[model samples]
Target: MRITGHHPLWRIAAAVLGGYAFTWGFIALGMAGAFALGMSFHDAEHLTAIIGFLIYLVLFLWAFAARSLARVWAVTAGGALVMAGAASLIQHQLT
Candidate 1:
């Protein structure tokens, strides 16, 4: 999975997109988990921000380190979707 056959800019773009996906996805998932645990809104937000950075760094590394740009997107998008769905479900349950 050599990163090839495209402009370097495209590769950089993919990495940037992947980084954003992972960063937000992790934060959303963290907040979702906190909500599922019945945490207050303020506490959930603070906790998500506190833990999200470290998680983002690891996920950002994972995104750029992928052998294929497409794989980076697939994993990031899939993870985000799953987390979003879970968050929605948890919120629904609470309401």
Candidate 2:
């Protein structure tokens, strides 16, 4: 079935929810990585990592609200790259 011209509000809601789910999933994966790396949750660095995750989450939500899938993808991908870069920077800074 061909779906056409869905309400922009519905599109926005779907996009936001999608972005939230994606962000949460990524955060969970990062937490798992931290555990693997023997990083304790009580560490100040852990808090910084969570703050970075929140920044990415906000970026994703902003992109979703813009209602352009191409822009959303670009922002999401860019955020992911930035997150990875940030991780490397954090490692260098901490070590």
Candidate 3:
């Protein structure tokens, strides 16, 4: 499907906003989960939350800048995978 220039502009904007919303929502949920688990945000475990939020933000921006749906999906998914992998490796080494 072809997205017109103007249409893609709106889609990009929506992607950015939607991505931001999703990131914040996840952060809130993470914080809530921590609280429920009796863990404070001051704990080292909360580092994962920060990494996840940054990954989501980057993926959203990647998707927004994409020219096509396929491209957007590919870029976003790839970014997520890379981010997740890096986070896991770093966390593993830190522990």
Error of 2 at 94 (Å): 23
Model 2: per-residue Cα lDDT over 4-95, one tens digit each? 58655544654565455445445544654564477785563475467657865676567545656656655555555655665555556546
**What would the TM-scores of all predictions be?**
0.74, 0.45, 0.51
Best by TM-score: 1
Please give the distance, in angstroms, between residue 81's alpha carbon in candidate 3 and its true position after superposition. 24
Please give the distance, in angstroms, between residue 20's alpha carbon in candidate 2 and its true position after superposition.
1.5
User: Could you tell me the lDDT of residue 53 within candidate 3?
Assistant: 70
Candidate 1 or 2, higher TM-score?
Answer: 1
- Give the winner by lDDT: 1 or 3: 1
Among all candidates shown, the one with the greatest lDDT: 1
Model 1 Cα lDDT, one tens digit per residue, 1-95: 54456745655665566556666776776777787788887898888887777766666676566667677677767777777777777667777
Please give the TM-score that candidate 3 achieves against the real structure.
0.51
Residue pairs in collision within model 3: none
Between candidates 2 and 3, the one scoring higher on TM-score is 3
lDDT of 3 by residue, 31-77 (tens): 54555556765652475467657857776676666667665654444
The TM-score between candidate 1 and the true structure equals 0.74
Steric clashes per prediction: 0, 0, 0
